[model samples]
Every structure is written in structure tokens, then in C-alpha cells.
Target: MSTAQPDEGTDRATPDALLHTRTGTEVTPEDVVLAAGRDVTPKNLEWAKRKIETEGVAALDKLLP
Candidate 1:
């Protein structure tokens, strides 16, 4: 599996970092990683969290695009 590596300095993010507690309908980072046959890593999780924070739920789209 191709796992992404985080650049130095940023705090490592958990796989569930991007998850929304109020809305129980979003696909989690773990699920996305599993479905893509990739390993979960702090960097990937961080990226996911960053995207969500910067782009709302639409981050999922840019995260791939």
C-alpha cells in the first residue's frame, strides 16, 4: 500500500480526524483508505483533516482531485 508521509512540524492526525460527529453519514478516512487498498498513515489522515477544514465536506472531492 502507498502511504503518504507528513512533512515535519505538523501534528499527526488520527484516521478519524476528518469525521463529523453530528452527521453520521460521512465516509471515514479509514473507510476511504481501506476501499482504496491503501494503508492509513498520519500524513494521509492529516491531509484529510486539512481538506475538511478548508473545504467543508467538499474536501473529499479535492482530496482526490
Candidate 2:
């Protein structure tokens, strides 16, 4: 039996972007609280703000990586 391989140089079609996609990379306090599995209450938001201020970039890096 013989088999054929796909063309390596062929260009594949890229999928269209979602209709309601977020365009910004800006991370908000809500993102932190939500990522930590906590409710988005006023106190939690305040804590997130302080965490961001103290940790600086580490806050987002910790959540993502």
C-alpha cells in the first residue's frame, strides 16, 4: 500500500476573530480576585489593589505564569 503526504508549503486559512473579544491586555483587580476564586466584593477589590501596588508586575505574572 502507498500513502500521500500533505503539501508542506500550503497556506492554511486563519479563523476569524470572535465577535465580542477584549482588545486590551490591561489586567484589572477583578481579574485577580476572580483568578483566586474569590467573590468580587468591595473588600476583595481593595485587597487586590493593595496586592497589585505592593507586588507590582509580580501580581499579574503570578496569576498567569
Candidate 3:
């Protein structure tokens, strides 16, 4: 006879859980702006980078805040 074990690897933390673990100061507008420009889509990345450079970190509000 064999015993079945539950799969722990299948479970992953939700966004809320991830957020809770973050340091409040780490989620600043500057980080948001940089992240926005890092998309894999070439067009979006170019556009985002330009937006960040021209508009500054405030533009990240559309995506982060």
C-alpha cells in the first residue's frame, strides 16, 4: 500500500500575498516608471521609455497607482 501526498509545489502566492511581503518604501513611483519601460513588446517598450524620459516618473501612475 502506498500513501498519497498533497502537492505543495502547485500552490503559488497570490499578488496580494506578494504585495504584503514588500517593503512599503520599495514600491515607489520611480520603480514603477522603470518597470513600465521593461515590457517585452518592442513597440511598447520604446513608447514607455520615451514617456518615462520625457514625462518623468509621474507617468507611472497610470500603471502603478
Candidate 4:
């Protein structure tokens, strides 16, 4: 995952707006949820976590690539 520093004139930096990979593509929490095959909701993070734990980083190949 990547971190973003707020640009000039921005009020705040949002983690959800940061890119999660080196390609510089922006990703939202909703993108993460959908990537993990779940609904666009906060609870989907849990599903993503479980998938990672069970399948390893390779599980995210489709999403990240």
C-alpha cells in the first residue's frame, strides 16, 4: 500500500483516495471492497482480510494487477 501527503491547498489527505500500488492509480475503499468480491460497504474489509489470510498475497493478483 501507498501513502499520500496532502497537496498544497488541500484541507486534508484521505487514505481512501491514495493509490494502493506503485502504478499511481487511485483506489477508494469501495474499490477494495469490490476487488474482494463483496458489496461496497465497510464490512467488506473483513472479507478482504480473511481472503488475504487464507489465500496469501496471490489472492489479490487480480485486483492489484
Highest TM-score model number: 2
On lDDT, the stronger of 2 and 4 is: 2
CA RMSD of each candidate after superposition = 16.0, 8.2, 7.8, 13.1
Each prediction's whole-model lDDT (CA):
0.57, 0.72, 0.55, 0.60
Which digits, one per residue and each the tens of the lDDT, describe model 3 over residues 1-65? 99987698867666643443234443343455355656356566667667667766545645552
Cα lDDT of model 4 overall?
A: 0.60
Backbone clashes (count) for model 4? 0
Cα lDDT, model 3, residue 53: 71
- For model 3, what is the alpha-carbon lDDT of residue 34? 58
Kindly report which residue stretches of model 4 are placed more than 4 angstroms away from their true locations once superposed.
1-32, 36-40, 62-65
Listed in order, each prediction's TM-score against the native is: 0.39, 0.55, 0.36, 0.37
Worst 10 residues of 4 by lDDT: 19-28
- Which model is ahead, 1 or 2, in terms of TM-score? 2
C-alpha lDDT of candidate 1 relative to the true structure? 0.57
By summed lDDT, which 10 consecutive residues of candidate 1 come out lowest?
56-65
Candidate 1 lDDT tens digits, 1-65: 99998878778655665754334467566544444456789777765566566766554443342
Off-target runs (Cα >4 Å) in candidate 3 are 1-39, 63-65
Which is the better candidate, 1 or 3, if ranked by TM-score? Answer: 1
Whose lDDT is higher: candidate 1's or candidate 4's? 4
